[model samples]
Target: MSHSIAPATISSPKDLIAYKVDNAEPVEFTSSKGYEERRIHSEIYKRHPHIHAVVHSHSEAVVPYAISVAPLRACYHMAGFLGADGAAVFDIAKHRDPAQGADMLVRNEQTGAALAKTFDNSNRVTLMRGHGFTVVADSIEVAVMWAIYTQKNAAIQTTAATLQSTYGGTGSDMPLSYLSSEESSVAREMTKRTVERPWQLWVREVESCGLYVNTA
Candidate 1:
């Protein structure tokens, strides 16, 4: 589980708490704050064995599209992992159990399973309505790549749409031309080979800022 205060850091293996798919509490340690949300990751891993890394982010740029009627599309070649059809938004309300009550968070196994089912083998990203988005990949680097580009894509698309609406009078309601399926497919393959490039850059930044210390 991750600490609510510092969501991005993993100082050591001690930061991780082992837990089963069915249980809400960590078997080895006392529960952390916001521990219930960890169910989302466990359920996703239970459903997709091939996915080794899962990243959930509350990016402001992507949240608008998730809450809006429009879906977030892959506006550029780097974001090809989002696919041509765009990412699907998962609505917790429809799947929530009224008896258990609703908090819009994946707090239990049932809600987590519902969230997991929203993802298919080919789907790499799923946006949570009024919440955030999750990305799954075979490796941590690829997952980070998808997560970063998803935010970038949303910002770029929003800016482009605003420009069109302001200057061209097309309105933001109109859909901008997105990448074609063929374009995305080929680009997705090509981009996988370059994931390490950005990962190295980010690692360097972390080191330079002294955000991560190597105890080993």
Candidate 2:
């Protein structure tokens, strides 16, 4: 989806930008990038019926791992949506074009379609090589946590890698031994059972902080 410009300063409902998506092609709103946003968002929605929301954010912590060989592992249960296996990085230049113009941005529908297809039902997160990351979820709340978890996970992974290096460790290292196939399956199943618990907890926290504006 097209992210809000200067979203952190958004204090009122009027500060947000909303768009009506359709099955047809997307038109550019302010500039050429607007068409790119329209097609990508609409195409993703069409492809994944379960996905009600998408988040595109840049994480400084995740930038290195995205551009480098380091992979995003499923190390944290809080970000269980990353799946038990691990994460994948979508590189437009590598995957789409090796010689010509394969910019990191999702500037076309084909690129957007390719990126959207990268995520199956098992995983909802992907690192855009050289750019940033995108998080897909059933709702905005879940998507928000997914984004946070992904950034935190990247930070933790980097720390773990550094510590291992400090300890004279090398090759296929992580904070802890990654989850086995069996363990990963069980972890995902447990997340399905406990999905709403964290949402409720977050609601209480937001209300307590007086940041819970009833937009609905």
Candidate 3:
């Protein structure tokens, strides 16, 4: 399916840059490979107009988990972002080329389409091994929230694993009952507000950093 970039309603590239800088991470939109990054971002943004931004990153823990033979299952309630059972893992192994590096596209439009197919009618997050994680939402805030929280969940699971050997806790197990009704209600409300705000703060952030430019 053809996907278009959604117009900025609240946030701007500046805002996203600032958020990344503050978090000590490089902004994907401003990197040398920004074009491909933007393409992926735009595709998701167009398909989900209600969302403000789509963020992807290579987190330390997630990177190892992605390359592992075993899938990273949601082991705690805080990882509800992965969805009730956990999200699907996309194998980008074939996309990796020693000459081209790990940036090879394992699957093109077809891959993206198939990867997204699993999330149909659901708010599931996906793990693109050797690539990163993709979180789709109705707004930038929600996207950012998921990006941050998902990393946290991974860290928690890792820590739990270390503790499990000695303490003997459940392994990579996330019970749906762990998701409280109140948290779910709040998530819905937050999503609504994020869609309304767009990337207002993100825009200001980019401007303040003196990185605002009309690349188009």
Q: Write the per-residue lDDT of candidate 1 for residues 1-216, one digit (tens) a residue.
A: 655547446676656667665554667655455466888888888988888888988899999998897779889999988888999889999887898766788888888888888787588899999899999888999999999999999999899888888878875566688999999888888778888888999988987876675553
Model 3 lDDT tens row, 47-126: 55455556666677676667675455555544555644455676755433445445545333434444545346665577
**Candidate that would win on lDDT:** 1
User: Measured by TM-score, how close is model 3 to the native structure?
Assistant: 0.56
Candidate 3: misplaced stretches above 4 Å?
A: 1-34, 45-52, 69-78, 93-102, 105-108, 169-216
TM-score of 1: 0.89
lDDT of each: 0.83, 0.68, 0.54
lDDT, residue 173, model 2: 43
lDDT of 2 by residue, 99-174 (tens): 4365566755567788888776656888887888888877787777778778998888788778888885675543
Cα error of candidate 1 at position 43, Å: 0.9
* Model 3 alpha-carbon miss at residue 121, Å: 3.3
Clashes of each: 0, 0, 13
Instruction: List TM-score per model, in order.
Output: 0.89, 0.74, 0.56
Q: How far is candidate 2 from the true structure (C-alpha RMSD, Å)?
A: 4.3
